[model samples]
Target: MKVLALEGQKHIKSFIDFPHDLYRNDPNYVPELYIAQHDLLTPGKHPFHDHSKVQLFLAYDDQNKVCGRIAAILNNNHNAFNNTTDGFFGFFECINDQKVATALLNQAELWLKKQGITTIIGPANFSTNETVGLLIDGYDSPPVVMMPYNYSYYLQLIENAGYAKKTDLLAYDVPYDTHNDRSVRLLGALQARLKRSNIIIRKVNMKDFKNEAAKLRDVYNQAWDRNLGFVPMTEKEFDYLAKDLKMIVNPEFCLVAEQGDKFIGFALGIPDINQVLRKVKRGRLLPFGIFKLLFGLKKVDWLRVMALGVLTEYRKLGIEACLYGLIIQNAISNNIKGAECSWMLEDNYMMNNAIEAINGKIYKKYRLLEKAL
Candidate 1:
């Protein structure tokens, strides 16, 4: 097998399409949107390229058939923010063949080494801010929106490649009926308690979304600063992501906590669009696929409680419980059957315990792997 640095639009197309072909027979595999993937991989279209560099590699067999693909990513912003000479390998996919897998990983390592990077960590499509980690468990069902799914054998392949686990990201399944209704019942009292402290929780206001997003961005960066591999997003990067989410965001599922006029925390839960996208063949939204996505929104029964964070100073003040409780309450009221509270750090006991308190089941686990260069 031979690995080559992706060069042209043709190669880029192949890099994006490889996963579809790789998982063609897997019923749980969900095809990510083709246009979104194209734009993300293109430098000018995505804000990530404004401050970082990514090199795509495609592996080919003796007959020149694509066998694997990987990306060597140097996130300049992350290095500058965290003070580490770290590199990342993401957008990785390979057949069970060790030779092809090794070649793809080697190519990425060689590319990063040439650029002066000393260590590597990932499966992060770009960064922790985006889709990251390998799905090591939970193959029984499809992933929720913005989460990833991969072959179960990938765990063995990555470990065999000498990558050690850097951390595990947790995903919990919370069925509405199973959740402790105590949180929902206490929602009113909790809000009143917060109000007594000059803090109140409210749905994200859509009419003033741009302004609200800017404030929430600050809370996001500050709240998640202590996380592993954490890096505050640039203004442009935050805005770029917020724009796409705005299209699918239900204001009711997006809540914010404030003290007087100061934003203290926020929780955002988006409908699992994957419920619709999974049926949109090859991730294309053309012809009938577009209709499926548009009409399928109302029928989406699951929610991905994608993000919930509070400023450091505000921790232990019941803000976390209030945020989570409110999201769960809203989900129930909307007829959403359940939600996935996910990608949590395994060591985040406060958050994990809070989820556990709500009776959320640890249904899936993902790993972030690392190797010294």
Candidate 2:
């Protein structure tokens, strides 16, 4: 087998298309859009390149058949914020063979070591700000849009390669039909109390998205500053991400808390576009794939409460509960069957408690692996 660095346009195409062939028979696997992946991996197209660097590699058999792929990333912001030189490996896909997995990981580690990195941590496709973690549980069903799905054996392959668990990220499922009734009853009262304090929760204003996103940027940076591996996003990066999400942002599920004219807290729920994207085939929208995405949007049954944050001074004021309640209410009204509030750090007690209060069940688990290079 030979490992090759993805260089020219042809190799780049191979890098993006490899997953389609790898998971063709896996019913639960979704093919990410080829265009989106291309833009993201391209240096100037995605904001990650502004402060970080990444290298893509593809492994091939003696016959030149693509066998595996991996990405080695050096996130300068992550290193500067955490005060450690840690590299990352993401977009990892390999055959069931342990040797293939080991070879891909070893190459990634060696590349990072050459850059003076001391530790390697990932399966973070690019960064924690984007899709991160390898799915270690919940393979019975397809992942929600933007969430990850992987073969169960990949876990063993990673462990066999000598990476230890760094942290486990949890994803909880809140079924509309069986959610905790007590919390549902309390939601009304919570909203009433919040109203008395002049805190209003409303859908995001699309007309003012630029301004709304700016307010959210402030709240997000402040709210999650203490999170493990947290890094403040640059303006360019934030805007780039906001623009991508804006296309699918539902005003009803994307909400904000306001006291008079000041934005205090926010919650963003996006339709699991992965449902539609699963049929997108190699992540391309053109050549007939666009219609599936365009029409599938209306039929998406799941929503992901990807982000929810409240200002520190606003804690315990029921603002967090209100944000969740509003999103749940929208979910119910839209006839969406369930939602996943995800990728939460295992140690986030406050957020976990709030989700548990609403009878959210821990349904999926993803882990970040680490090794001393």
Tell me the number of clashing residue pairs for each predicted model: 0, 4
Model 1 stretches astray by more than 4 angstroms: none
lDDT of each: 0.92, 0.89
What TM-score do all the candidates reach, one by one? 0.99, 0.96
TM-score of 2: 0.96
- Cα lDDT for residue 366, candidate 1: 99
| lDDT at position 154, candidate 2 | 93
Question: How many clashes show up in model 1?
Answer: 0
Question: Candidate 2 overall Cα lDDT vs. reference?
Answer: 0.89
Every model's Cα RMSD, please?
0.9, 1.4
Question: Could you tell me the lDDT of residue 141 within candidate 1?
Answer: 98
| Candidate 2 backbone overlaps, count | 4
